[model samples]
Target: MAHLDTLDDEVPDISPYVTPISPTNRFYRIDTALTVPQVDPESWRLRITGLVDNPYELTYQDIRSMRLADYVITLSCVSNQVGGRLVGNAIWTGVPLYELLQRAGVQRGAQQIVGRSVDDFTAGFPTTLAYDGRNAILAIGMNNEPLPTRHGFPARIVVAGLYGYVSAVKWLEEIRLTTWDGFDGYWVPRGWSKQGPMKTQSRIDLPSHGSRVNSGETIPLAGIAWAPTRGIERVEVRIGNEDWTPCRLGQAAGNESWVQWHRDWTPSGGGRQQIQVRATDGSGHTQSGRTVPPRPNGAEGWHTISVDVR
Candidate 1:
């Protein structure tokens, strides 16, 4: 195993709030591994075992020969606080995990599918999710480039609508189906939600807080919103105690990808002012105003930032 970075919260710094597609180099990563595993594609083997009628292994070439699809998706770390910089969007290329599982033929008793990494790290989710219309895949490419060593080189796991802790297994070596009723991921025992569904969240990107913008001039307020399986329907911005105003959303590739939103705001009076943002998902659920920390699962509440107007 090679050395690894424990946690990286580095988000896009240049107009980060407006950039819809995050560059592969600027994406965030979180891991508990003390060292990253280096797996050679030529020597790699993906084994499917346990509770299956046709247990088999697939070589790297085997994976490449299968039909490949592009998944433009956004993923966020569970530890990210409200308005935190641990979220990113990228186009991942891989084969749908469902295809592999179907070929292996899951047994009747299988309840969960566990993905074990070369570094010995493991995380899995309910088997139902694999066939439940969610796009879970074994990602071999990130942003049109080969997967980075730090970001699961040969391949990794990406499941729509789920948090990274329970689904994003990197440097994958084996996928095993389990009938254990009490199976838990690495983070579950360490205090996290077992299911790990992602929560709807938004962030403010433009007009750095504390920077002064001239009053009477229209200032553009913008950011990004993500809801995974359920797309963001609308984004609303609040100025100080003013009523919520709708923001124009940019074109989105799909429901699984994050969308950009922006609205022009003209400061009424000079001095300090506050801006807050909230989002309503395609399922008609709006983000709550109640503030909560990102523990056990994900964070909650609107993203608020204060700015100075001259």
Candidate 2:
């Protein structure tokens, strides 16, 4: 867990929610294996095996030829600290996992759906997640373009609301259906929680940290907030020692996408000022105040930043 926590510093900061349509280059990527797996699409095959009644395989083209669906989903890494940039939103296009599993005829007593990457890194979630109507997919495209090699070239799994460790298996090659007691993926043994549900999170993008600004000038305090499968209902910002003030929200792209938010603030006196932000989900859940490090599960805490005004 200590090593995983340190990896958060390696991720470059990007305003994940500011642009719900995050550009491909700005998307944060964290790979467990030492080297990125090179997968030749033409030779790539997705194997469906294990407890299923019918084991089968599908090529990259075969997946594309199937009925395709596009969705704007936000992915958050469990290793992401409060205000971290390890989250991104993009329109993903792929075949539904439910449809694929149905075709394979998942047998009775099956309890988990495991996805194996070309690098041999594996991640699995409960079988119920595939059919839970949360829009799980075997994504082949991202932001209207083929997935970038570093971000899972051929295909990856995207499940709304879950942390990337549990659902964002990249360079995906195989899905095995098995029992709960069957196996543990890469992160499980590393001390991460099996069910990586994302916690409510928000960030401050503008007034770049440590930037000098004019005192008494009206400045926009803004950023993005997300609650995964549940949309962000509202965002609020607080100036040093002031009450939380509501901020206007931008149109959310989809139920699983992040929403943009901003509030205007005038600095009365300038020295060193701290800005804090928090969010409430559509389900009426507010971000927690107690800070927790990203470890066995996702992190929980309000995102705060400071800047100097001249």
Candidate 3:
């Protein structure tokens, strides 16, 4: 977690609103299984089975030839604690999972779309989310480049507004359709939520935590806010005894991506300053002030940060 620095005229607006992390940025990575498997693209195949009318398979080349869709999506882990750094944004390129499922002829009784990775790890979500107008993709490209090995090299699923545990299956190998009662992905039995809808979250990214600034110096307060598929409507920040003030929001790439925000602040008195930030989604839901630990579901509450002012 990088801290915010003293704002100077030469400093480019350090707000996420002014600049978003690039797709190729060093994103946080996690694997349920101990090992991250390396797969050969040429030999790999994506299997579609179970409740699909046409049980079939596609090789790397076969999938690449399909109509490729692009999206800038953010992925959050269900285990992300308050003010966690496990979330990231990327421009993903792939076939829409909804379209692929349609082409494969999903059977009428199919209730879940389960993704299987080469390592045998699996996770899934409701079948309706695939065709219900969400930007869910069987992603193969990231940041205009081939997906990186550490980030699910050959392919992965990019479903907006859901925690990675339920949606982002990395190093893909299969897509299986089944009844809701017939399946439990890797995380469900382990106590994570079955449907990992993302929680609205906001974070302070600048002025590295615990850093100091001179009293009365105007500083740039910047961070990012996200609500996934619903998008972010606004972000507000409160410093010391001040009332919440709206921060400027950056243009979002799509409903699934995050937006940067920032505000200029000058300290009235020196010592320690505590700041609280919250967000309202496009759906008109403001983040909860009540704090909850990340558990079966996502965490809820405002992110608070403190800094020193001499």
Candidate 4:
């Protein structure tokens, strides 16, 4: 785990509203309040209320008694840079959120579920996605190990097909069914788009900047790409705006994580060169050409980097 520097060096040099980058290198923000004093599961309680036929609360042991399943999931932060460190893959173990909601009996006209975290952060998600068959889990374990403190220790929410901001609530405290008009989440109130969907993107990992390679030797270039809830169908690499060549993509582990890819490139001569990577999802949606910041929605565009071949 790496720590990131997200604090403003001085008090008033920049805009006050700028989102503080997290000290943890992980893409997601770590709630300072709740994370300070490690939350204990034995003393934890999850409350379900508002617009439900049966308003109730459950203790940690009560939730643990429910059926549990393990799933491999990938989480990506909406504010992550083009090749940022705000993404990770883990095996999560938890009960489906839909099953719990069913027991609570959602009332009619409920379009969203407002999720609250122990740190007072809130996220509003469409109720249909929360109740439908899609795997929306209240995760208790990650990577077959107890949830790491930085990744939401006691519990966190993991929903497919949505961006991390709305789906990955850490140190979950309560879930309340409500109408869309009833609430606005942290990001939504800050001018970010209400709806979030992960975009298809790829990155190169091997032959890092200033790497040296033999003039005529074949260098292996490897990386990963993702289209959450969908599989990656193909990956292509281009050199200097030339024709794109297909790279070999490894078999996908699951629908929610990234797919690894590798390609071989032989340097004709020793010089500086640029490489670009792009990917296509199972649905055949190509990556976007326009570049957009991660604030309003997810970032988009091909990832490119320059390297030197000696």
Candidate 5:
């Protein structure tokens, strides 16, 4: 077993799904490294090469010297199952990826942007995401603190809306521009798709499954929903056989971040009640009812939990 599972394997961890920003330590991590790569910030360099007219190397200082912006975005692992915890939101400080690509003078034939980590893990996405209004950055800081080594010490790649497998690469060392057929990421050969867009999803945190609660009192239920670039339009909750009811949403951080939502329900009859939650994305598409695993791309299905009401 991997040493840092905090339970079984480091591949999965409970996410700190708090609002606005989650505490850094509690933020979830998902990566392919068996051993964390230790890097010397002084000697570390980011190479922007391949299909660019101005290929160059950027030192850690050189990367951070650019005007950086703070982006509050949510990142989720491709392996995160429905209602799973391999997701987190944080404020990342970094330079716009397009800024770096602009400096490199992306060649006309470049279609893919491959981010390769020191450990040799690579993820490829469309090069257009950077200059075409998508939220893409080379992050140096997370939640106001220097990027923790556990999360990607000196730098990482972050592109909102896409699953981490396709968009987030930690301990990043190179940004290689290539064509669609130029390369396949590690996961792509493992059967996952080249593109891993996140599915609209929501989960109930309070009144956890199998917990007992007083029947007469109002059941204060709350959780989070995320749709990323499309943004969460709204969240709905269902109790027992009741129709879906709108949940009161907490302040929305941005279209790229998760939103908090809560609902207070008074059960007229007490027993074992089943609760389910779903979300609608800004595109007006509701979460799918079809249950799917996280292997090929991402998970889908309404998050369901059962609680015993006394």
Candidate 6:
């Protein structure tokens, strides 16, 4: 049995960076050690076994037979630094994981369910989370389109309330119930936390850096924030050490995705002004004033950026 206590105790404070306009423009350098396998749905089968009384192997047709539900979700990579672009919002469609697990009848002593992806990457999540009723899906589609090759393709696992490392298992193939003993996922071995629930955080989007804006004119500042499953309760904006003020949050795209916010601000004789954003979740959890790195767990603190008004 592998002890969870052996995991590293290091949690670096979040490093705040000016939120870039083109956060996803940079190439996400892939680690050469991680292997990605090509997927063919015709040859694909999802095997559910180990610690289940009725071991089942499901074909594509079988999965398609299950009822499909749709919802929007925000996925953030643990490697994404504070204000980084490794996050995206998409509408996903698929069968609920708990429904399938109920059909399989989990056996006693199964503490964790190890999900293996076609890419050969693996992550283990606690069984309690896997069976939670809130939007945990064996997703086959995204944004009303087939899952893209780079984004899970044939099938993936989407679990609410956790970081992408464990909740978003791309190119999923097999799920095995385990005892939480001698189990470590791809990122876990690399010093990430086994459990991840996204933190409450917000970003600044309008009046991009290096862009010219009219001085003393009211401009709409916009961005998005999320606290999955638990919706973003409130968003606040601050300009240059000013008091935080509430911003208007648009209709949420979905329960698991980012909520858009907008606030109108007039530049006060500014050469350059720093705008900051923070959010509170439905649980009343507020964004941390203290920053932290995005590792082991999700990133922390508010996102900020500076823009010039000419």
Where does candidate 2 have its weakest 10-residue lDDT segment? Answer: 1-10
RMSD of 6: 9.3
Model 2: how far is 291 from its true place, Å?
0.5
Residue 297 in candidate 3 has what lDDT? 94
lDDT of 4 at 250: 64
lDDT of 6 by residue, 101-165 (tens): 78788988888878888767788888888656667788987666677666676888878767778
Per-residue lDDT for 135-159 in model 4, tens only? 7898887666667767777788888
List TM-score per model, in order.
0.94, 0.92, 0.93, 0.87, 0.94, 0.86
For model 2, residues 127-217, the per-residue Cα lDDT tens digits are 8988877879999998888888888989999999899888789999899998877888889988998888888899988768777778988
Give the distance in Å from residue 34's predicted Cα in candidate 2 to where it truly belongs: 2.2
Task: Write model 5 residue lDDT over 1-310, tens digit each, in one string.
Answer: 0011111121122234644577788899889999989999999999999999999999999977888878888999989989888889888989899988888999998999999999999999998788777689999999887899989989999999899998799999999999999899879998999988888888887767898888688767788899989999999999878889998777667889888777777766678889999999999999977999988988999999988878
Worst 10 residues of 1 by lDDT: 1-10
Query: By summed lDDT, which 10 consecutive residues of candidate 5 come out lowest?
Result: 1-10
Q: Root-mean-square deviation of each candidate, in angstroms?
A: 5.6, 6.4, 3.8, 8.8, 6.3, 9.3
**Candidate 5 lDDT score at position 253:** 71
Off by over 4 Å in 5: 1-16
Poorest 10 consecutive residues of model 3 by lDDT? 1-10
Error of 3 at 233 (Å): 0.8
Query: Compared to the true structure, candidate 5 yields what TM-score?
Result: 0.94
Alpha-carbon deviation at 221 in model 2, angstroms: 0.7
Q: What is the RMSD of candidate 5? A: 6.3
Model 5 clash pairs are: 5-9
Residue clash pairs of candidate 4? 4-23, 27-86
lDDT tens string, model 1, 1-310? 1111211122233374346667777899898779887788999999999889999999988988989988888899999999988988888889988899999999998998888899888887998988888789999988888889999988889999998999999999988998756477788788887788999999888767777889999877777899999999999999999999999887776889888887777897778899999999999999999998999889999999899888
